[model samples]
Target chain A: MAIKVAILGYGTVGEGVYKGIQNHQEQLIEKLGDAVEVAGILVRDPLKKRDVQPGTFITTRFEEILAIPGLHAVFEAIVGKEPGYTYLSQCIEKGCHVITANKVLFAKYGNELLKKSKQHGVHIGYEATTAGAVPIIRTLQELLKVNRVTRIQGILNGTSNFILTEMRANRLSFGEALKLAQDNGYAEANPENDVEGKDAACKLKILCQLAFGCTPDWEEVEVEGIAAITSGEVQKAEAEGFRYKHIADIRAEGGKLKASVKPIAVSSAHPLFSVEGVDNAITLETSLAGNLTLQGAGAGKFPTASAMLEDFSAILEKSLRTKIHLLSARVPV
Target chain B: MAIKVAILGYGTVGEGVYKGIQNHQEQLIEKLGDAVEVAGILVRDPLKKRDVQPGTFITTRFEEILAIPGLHAVFEAIVGKEPGYTYLSQCIEKGCHVITANKVLFAKYGNELLKKSKQHGVHIGYEATTAGAVPIIRTLQELLKVNRVTRIQGILNGTSNFILTEMRANRLSFGEALKLAQDNGYAEANPENDVEGKDAACKLKILCQLAFGCTPDWEEVEVEGIAAITSGEVQKAEAEGFRYKHIADIRAEGGKLKASVKPIAVSSAHPLFSVEGVDNAITLETSLAGNLTLQGAGAGKFPTASAMLEDFSAILEKSLRTKIHLLSARVPV
Candidate 1:
């Protein structure tokens, strides 16, 4: 039987998820041992033109998608905490697995959703929650099993990093860099979230949960944006043998999980210093493995969708019986 | 009932695995829902003075370790192909999950062992067979499900990278840098495998299997050692705005897998250029996620052990029941 799934929201991530499944359907089926069919997509307007398959069901109501017979999972890409949280909660309650790239919603309700998903006997995959396409989430899940995370420093926001790179590379002013980033489709219309470090902090929050298994007080987490970093400062830092990188630093101090997102001058010896453009890099200090760094695209249609699909593949792997079973199970027991 | 496991070979990786399990006992148990105990150690000399726990069993015979009742898994840290392959084969036939860091053995007999292990109803984990502690294997397993990898470039050998970095940074000759690397415990006494790029090629061969799902013929792989690199060339490359790095370049051409490990002059803008010292990095060009680079300690006692342990943890997670049982299973069936 086909593994029925749905897409929640019709934005970039949602569309990428759709295309990824459609394009990689054969590979997915080969790995999953079953065909995955997108039963429906929950979007704001069903009438709005989208790059969707003709046979795909598009609707504004979450209930309509939820009512799809034998729906196995939902990929939530909705913008906010509201409908995403409610829809995912309902999906879990109805016994459907969920995967999301929404850091804001996940950062706020991750612990609760994780608990709820556990309660419902379904998996909640948030690989797209941080460092898109870097594979940090699954890496952390594996490493943190037997290792204690000492420190996590991340360049989580691609927009901020892109702006900072432009400012330093071309001597562009903050306004010019931000405008260029927006023109390049790297930044959103209201750039406060990207420029003000909220996006990085949200990603950092999600990371802290996976790495340290501790959630910090949302209000206590210090956040500072890259908008204050001027061209003169960028040049001065360059002259002083450093680059201004917007870093989300999370570490445990005296048994308390503390996090801060701010612009920091990084030297050439540092890992994040080389992570240029819209690339996101995370340097993790671990108990067993020592220092490790992962760098990749932080945001994009295909990148973010790749993470969600990874989660989907993981879910499928867990649900499916071991493929090597013929050799093992053939021996009469 | 504790999860019973064994360590074959008392080398750096084996000793590290032993100590890692002992140190992270609580964390492992918490995550796995059961305690894990090292049942035996397969070593050449049981009388050898090692940092082994007092009650742990030490034996030179693989059969002795295999005889331990209820042995769930065996960590094969043994070097070379003979005993490692033969012993792992026996372990699999007996229904014991095997995790190994032996790239040479895995590169040679991995397909056979994997096939045999599946037939015997066990898992063969070789996370440490490639880039140690970089989490590339699991990451590729997730990403490769729905993505086609175009190219894989890696600084796979840390000793070669360290030698190159020393040659450039201190203006040392290849001989001097290799000596320095050996002194710093980065290069082995036989440095042939490391400096000659065999180690990196061995690792690259393994990575090719995971990323492209095809094994290249050994003779067809173009292998080049870093020993011929002169300090003058290194300095000249530096002057020309590039740094020479030992890279394992693997790509699919016309549906055939080709791999080469050689030192190439990489610019500052490149991901592998910034990777220095006893660190390994891999840049994978994915059809969906674009280019993603992962860098970490490729070889070390703790680092390599961490990879094996991560594989062990993954095995345990698959074997054990889900933790959130009350939430899902409590409903009326």
Candidate 2:
């Protein structure tokens, strides 16, 4: 049985997903024991020449995907709200397992989407929505099932980490570093989400949900961007034998969850101090596992897409079974 | 259906696995949909009053586990080669899924054991053999299935990392740090295996097998312990805007694998440079994902046991269908 997958969006991550799936087709088929084929691609501009190889069935119309017969799964790589979120909801409703790299959707409407996914008996995996390549969500949901989670502290945003690392190394100002990040394609043109901690906050919400089973109120999360921290502060922290890192922290206490995304002074003693420049590190403290840390690329074309591939593989595994109880519940704010 | 499991050694990791299994019983049953019960425990002295819960059977005989009718899997946490390796081989031959935290066994006899395991139709998992809480084995096995790994470098040993961390922070010599590590239960009184890079080398060999499909020749691997690195070198590295880290480097070039355990001068720009103290970090450079780094406690009772539980859950999941394939093959030394 060949699993037919349709990709929604033809952006960087979307293209990476396509290219990666093509590059490892034989190996993936061997692992899957069933062939996986990309049947259709829903892109903004279907006629645009992509650098990488994309299959023939490309379309600008979103409905073309929903109408495509035998599409077992949908890979949503579209950014922001509107059509991406709306289309994903419809995909789950139409009995398609969804793998998304959209943090904004998961952060805002994860509970709703999860509920719908369960009702439709489909899975909504957002592993790429948080940390690009790291399997933090799976680690918490599966591996740490037998452990009680205490806290999650992480350097979740790579752009901010890059800027901070540049400041620590080249003494570059925030603006200059931001420009460099933009040039390197690490930061968006506006760069508000990555720099202002919105991106990290969205990831923090997902982490809180997975680790504590509580969806944190995004607005309530105290966020401090790296824009405020100066080169002098970086030098001062260095002199004081500390490193400044933008950290997202979530802790569960007395059945209540508290989460924050802010810059913290990590000494030579802490693990996060060692994570520099566009790398994300997550420290999870569990009763059984003690303190476990996972670090990787927070965001990159192939890294983010690679995470989606993991989710895709997982969906294929679960879809082979007759029944899958996808958790969907309304988490109160 | 319930899966019956046996513990081969009632040591620190074994005890932790026992306690974690009992503590997370509800969650495990919920996630796996199978109740895992400890059927037997192998111990040196059956009469030794251990702090195990009542109702668990204890035995000194190795054949007892193999004879158990419902035994589906075995957890081997026993240290050293004497009976641990021999007993594990027996269990695999009897068609029992084996999960071991013994790096030495895997490093030396992994190829032989894996071949036997494949013939018996059982899976062999040693996620705990590397970084205890870190999911490097599974990450490489599952997540990077489609991607070709280029380079693997990290601080693979916790005891050595602790000693180096102490040496840098306290400005203590290597000997003094080793003494402190011993007193703090971080290192053994005879810490030659850890301090001499043998433990890390063993772990590196297993990782090489997974990453490159070639078993690293332990004799061919260049080993450099922290015994020679002085506090002066640590200070010098720090002054030169770098950090001295004991790194395990493995690279595959032109179908040839080169591996070494040595002290490397890591600049502030390197992700591993910030890993301090007893923390361990592994960086994998892949064709698709670029550089992905994971940091965590490389070894500890709870962390290592956590890896075992993960293996246990994975085995239970696979046992549902009784579909197990031996994926390890003997490579020429």
Candidate 3:
């Protein structure tokens, strides 16, 4: 039997997932021992000029795509809450696994989704939602099984990191770097989420939930973005043998977690000091394993798509026991 | 319901595994949804003064432990190949899963073990055999499922890295550094495997088998250890803003793999440049995910034991499908 999956949005990640599945069909089949077919693609505009695989149906109506028989997984790449959240919940309720790139929805309602998943016995894969290509979620889920976690910190946002990297490396001002990032498609026109640290804060909440098994309110996280950081400070930090990085940090002790996202100066000895450009790096401090660091592409189409595929493959093999990394009980502040 | 397991050879790793399992018993029980008990321990001296659980059984004979009922997994921590290999094979033949920290046995006979495991439908967990606490084996196994790995290079040996780090940071010669490493318990008295690069070569073979499903002869890999790295060269490289790192490299393209272990000069831009002390770091260049780097302690009693427990927890959940990351068929080389 072929594994049938649907893409919930026709955006960059959705298109990338479609293309990746199409391109690596044979290799995926070889590894999975079965053909994985894209059944339908849910789009707001069905007439949008897009490259799609043959026999793949495109529809604007969620009901049309959900009506497909034997849909094993739904790839949720749509933005914002509302319909994306509703579609994913319906998929899980119907016993279909969900793979998503929507960090905002996950950060907010992850705990609820996980409880629903546990009740329905379905997997929710959010690998693409956090660090794009970096498999930090899976790493934490697997390695932290036998180790006591102490601290989890990382450069989780690529847009903010990219802007900071441009400012420091090219001697550009924050505005100049922001402009460059926007021009290069690294930042959005309305880049409040990236500039004001909301993006990294959301990811930090997700990470803390996975690492410490505790959910933190996104509103309570002390967040400071890159917009307030000056090039002089960046240069001064560099001259003082330190690098300024936008970091999402969470420290856990006695089952309590404190989370923050801010522009932090780090010495050369720090792992996050070297993470630049659109790169993401996470350092995990554990009692047994010592300090472990994982670095990779923080965000992009292909990388995010590849992450989704990993989750898809794991779900297919019936190996993904942890349904939602971020979906657990919220710790009362 | 309870999952039962055993430990072979009550040495550093074996003892560490015991303590780790005992300390994380509650967490393991929660994760596995069942009580995981260490049923018996195989040792040369059962009466040796060691800290263990009150009800834990210890015996000097492997057959004694093997005769225990409901043994789900056996952890192999004994050094060398002979009786360890035979015991592991017998365990697999009897349909019990095996987890090992024996790198030599893995590099030498991984192919045969994998074939036997497949024939008997048993899992062979060797995450502890390479880069002890870093979880590189699991990372490669999970991440490479969706990405095409091109090149993998790393500082795989803790002793070599410790020596090189000491040689640079303290301006010590290779002999002085080796003495320091031994004094710190970082290197064994017979450090030939680490100092001659054979240990790294073995690890590289294991990594290659996991990454490319192919294994090159361990002896065939170009081996050059830090024994020849003088403090003069180290200072010279440092003065020129480069670091000399002993790297185990494997490149796969067009379904052919080339493996080598050598001391390479790396600039600050290189991910392996700042990896110091007993730390091990690996940089993987893939087709879709870009450059991914993972760093941590490559060897230690507690770290390697934690890796073993990870396998134990996975086996308890019956989620470990591909057990032997490196134990696979040899391609037509």
Considering just chain B, what TM-score does every model have? 0.95, 0.93, 0.93
For candidate 3, what's the RMSD?
A: 7.0
lDDT of model 1 at residue B14? 91
Classified by CAPRI criteria, candidate 1 counts as: acceptable
The alpha-carbon root-mean-square deviation between model 2 and the true structure, to one decimal in Å, is 6.6
- lDDT of model 3 at position A61: 92
Would you list the C-alpha lDDT of every candidate in the order shown?
0.87, 0.83, 0.85
- lDDT per residue as tens, model 1, B303-323: 999989888988878665432
Candidate 2 local lDDT, residue A208: 86
- Over B230-316, each residue of candidate 3 has an lDDT whose tens digit, in order, gives 899999999999989999999875667778899988898887888888988899998777788998888888889888888777665
Instruction: Score candidate 2 by DockQ.
Output: 0.30
Worst 10 residues of 3 chain A by lDDT: A324-333
Choose the strongest candidate by TM-score.
1
Q: In model 1, which regions exceed 4 Å deviation?
A: A322-333, B322-333
Q: Which regions in candidate 2 have their CA more than 4 angstroms from the true location?
A: A1-3, A33-37, A52-55, A217-219, A230-234, A320-333, B1-3, B33-36, B119-121, B216-218, B230-232, B321-333
Give the candidate number with the greatest lDDT: 1
Better of 1 and 3 by DockQ: 1
Model 3, residue A7: distance off in Å is 1.5
Listed in order, each prediction's TM-score against the native is 0.94, 0.89, 0.91
Worst window of 10 by summed lDDT in candidate 2 chain A: A324-333
- The residue-by-residue lDDT of candidate 2 on A77-181, one tens digit each, is 997877888999899989999999999988888999999999998998898998888778887776666677899998999999999999887889888889999
lDDT of 1 at A276: 88
